[model samples]
Target: MVAKNQTVVTEFLLLGFGDLHDLKFLLFAFLLIIYVMALTGNALVIVLVMIGQNLRSPMYFFLSQLSLSEFLFTSNILPGMLWLTLAGGGKISIIRCFSQFYLLAVCTVTQCLLLTIMSFDRYVAICKPLHYTIIMTFGLQLQIVTLCWSTGFILSIVLFGFLYRLEFCGPDTINHFYCDIGPVLELSCSDISSTKLVTSMLSTPLVVCPFVLITATYISIFNTILKISSSIRRQKAFSTCSSHLTVVCLYFGSLASIYIFSPKIGSNTKKNLSLIYILVTPIFNPLIYSLRNQDIRGAITKYIHLIGTWQLP
Candidate 1:
């Protein structure tokens, strides 16, 4: 299986923020701090959801899953990014690159499904409160979570198959930090029209379908809230959804900014946008939920007191 005109590329030079000659260390420090905060914030959400008896509802359960996905999503790319920043750009093996690519795809798809599911949970809680418990049982939530992760893994393999067939010949330099699809595809010597077409077809539905569903779900939710006679009840209903709505706005807004709206923007601009969804959003999840929802903040206070009591003589 020899391509006569192609030279197989075994590795790629990641030109990660290399222009920042004096600011490399600063970049590394910034990334490290973000990584730590993202990890801690998401991890705290998971722990709180697990131990807080009051958080046994479907909403919190789905939120814990979302936190786990965000945790994995950032961990997949940030470590490599940090190293590349510190080293002022470095070589990444093709196999390692592909591995990162696969995981990134999986996390992206999983998060999409999880957010959509969270919206549905909110819709049920707000629109059909009486039947919410029966509809969203513990077993049902577990099954849905399993399905989301499985679908993400299976779909990532499909995309990975497309990447596997490409022939990387020359120009083995990736202009960004991690193995992003656009940069990797740019290096391929193969005819990539079919690949691009398939990728667009695949990604469009994943991003758009869930987004449409969430938007429609919220429309119904808000309508239901508006019809409620008591102002206090309407306020409470809106409060439950505000955090998820804020998260959805931030997530999809940043994603559209980079991938959809600003395709013509410079590479550096794209990288900066990548940080918004990848690092900033994940770290802010715990803060958003905790500040908006009294349940998580109470859980944190209780957990801290428990730890303090245990440490006493």
Candidate 2:
């Protein structure tokens, strides 16, 4: 009926931070600062891990990969968001919008899989200390990291293939600052029941399966920790996992709220929740690791000393 009258939409008007006319400058400045901080923090973690010989381990390797994922994740979303906030909403070409969606999907799925792998690394360290080195060898670590990235990109391609078939006819305004699955799907004029089902199937592997694996790994890790005879060993084991646990809680909490509860909440609430993972979590990752991780702290201290002693050109 109404679908027949709809014109094909080639561009979308992103309703970013909608109508924040008075505080547009203020919000823009604030987000810019947060964006810079997120990049700097994640980039620092990557650099630290790369240069610090003492920090070369399965744990730090995973941490560096996670930092890289966070960097890519925020980089994909923030600059355009900043521009839209400053310009008071803007039009995005359909091609660029879909590209952004694809990159974000890849990064998000990669992070979920990486986190699960990281939890497994911890489980082996604590639960099977004797086999940790052999099990998480450098070659195996590289393979796992490769698998995470390849899987994410492959799944994103499949999902985007589904999205590409849909027609975006009229009503080209996206309610959020970004081209997320939910908002993008809502804009489609074509039947999305099959698309929705496929997306759900994809999400089960990307989101729910990884979450379940991480939970089970952590449960096993905790059970192992409780069996340790030495209190110091127990404390050390918990300390090793605490930073990851914090990130897992923040990541999964924000994601679950968005996917599970968005229907019950306002768009504004969903947008704000999106910030928790997209902005805050990335920035907090390095801070949590640096502050809580003795190895990272020591590496930073050493690096600072080296920098301090270097002669100026």
- Top-lDDT candidate index: 2
How far is 138's C-alpha from truth in model 1 (Å)? 1.2
Candidate 2 local lDDT, 206-235, one digit each (tens): 677888999999999999999999999999
- lDDT of candidate model 1 versus the reference: 0.89
Give candidate 2 misplaced runs (Cα > 4 Å). 1-5
In candidate 2, how many Å is residue 136 off? 0.7
lDDT (Cα, tens digit) per residue for candidate 1, span 1-313: 3377777888999998876887888888999999999999999999989989999999999999989988998899999999988788999988889899899889888988999999999999999999998999999999999999999999999888898888887889988889978888888888888888887887888888999999999999999999999999999999999999999989888877766655689888888898787788888888899899999989999989988889545
Error of 1 at 134 (Å): 0.9
The lDDT per prediction is: 0.89, 0.90
Error of 1 at 202 (Å): 1.0
